[model samples]
Target: MKWSIVFLLISVQVFSQKIIWSDQQKLEWSNFKSKVKTMRNPDVVAYTHCGWEYSSTVSSDPSVPVKIKITTIFREDKSWKDPKRINDYALLHEQKHFDIAEIYARKLRKEVMEHIKTSSDYNKNFKIIYNRILNEYKDFQIAYDRDTQNGMNKEKQAQYNASIAEALETTK
Candidate 1:
């Protein structure tokens, strides 16, 4: 009987907590890591929506691999069974940007610093592209949130749509 009360309290707390990562999330993270490794970007450690911050930078050395930290969302009224559809997609999307940036950086590194003493151009160009990517992603996210609102089972249709929209945006 005592154990049952404890179980009840724990269940209540859990249910009250916000949804975050799922089993599928772990697999998704692993797959993302695998794909990113292929991209050969050393500075990015991990990508995640939930973490110490939305995104951050890390140091790298020959002795240590650069890592990006990813975090999951905090407890909210939303369902944990269905996390944001765009969560992983967003990470992958950002990873691609990082890869592009790394490529651009590498190319720039090959040139003499005297040729372009300022990092302003690269920062500006990257910001424009990044904003466009994020904007389109947001549009998809809005559509998805709307689509998933009517489901009884809380299926992540919004997440699915967001993922698709992000992919299309990237490809374009």
Candidate 2:
């Protein structure tokens, strides 16, 4: 869980159909054409299944120090839209959800690096750190929807977008 990754998308391997997040790669309305869950509430407008994937390896050194890497993925197939609410503004809101995931990933990366560099036991602390950050990420995602009223508040949505972008840069 103590990752010391160099930079963004260092390895371009196709882990799956997941589209790794990027500023250049904005999600289009066409990307929202996937079918929605039938059992879900009809009132819901859209869903963005943004998530993170992590991998770890211990160094060859005797200590077997752990190295963890976390990457966020926007699960396009799992995500869906109501079709009626599909618009630039709605898509922007969805994009912010993905961007928010990146913010947490960056924060997680920074924490793991600092922990590995300073702590005596990296492996033991990895899970604690990972779980803590993961919890925070989930909370923030919910708070985002609540505060912005599911992207109805353009002002709040813009603020969240700015905060996410700034968090990403500072963590880098």
Misplaced by over 4 Å in model 1 are 1-24, 27-120, 150-172
In candidate 1, the residue pairs with backbone N, CA or C atoms under 3 Å apart (3 or more residues apart, or in different chains) clash, namely: 18-75, 18-76, 45-67, 45-68, 46-68, 50-71, 85-159
Query: Candidate 2 residues 36-148, lDDT tens each?
Result: 56326554578888878888776546365566778888876678888766678888888888888988988888888878642245656878988999999999999998888
Q: Roughly what TM-score does model 2 have, to 2 decimal places?
A: 0.80
Q: Give me the runs in candidate 2 sitting further than 4 Å from their true place.
A: 1-15, 38-43, 59-62, 117-120
lDDT of 1 by residue, 143-170 (tens): 5434543221134644554555464345
lDDT scores of the candidates, listed in order: 0.36, 0.77
Residue 27 accuracy (lDDT) in model 1: 26
Report the Cα RMSD per candidate. Answer: 16.5, 6.3
TM-score, model 1 to reference: 0.28
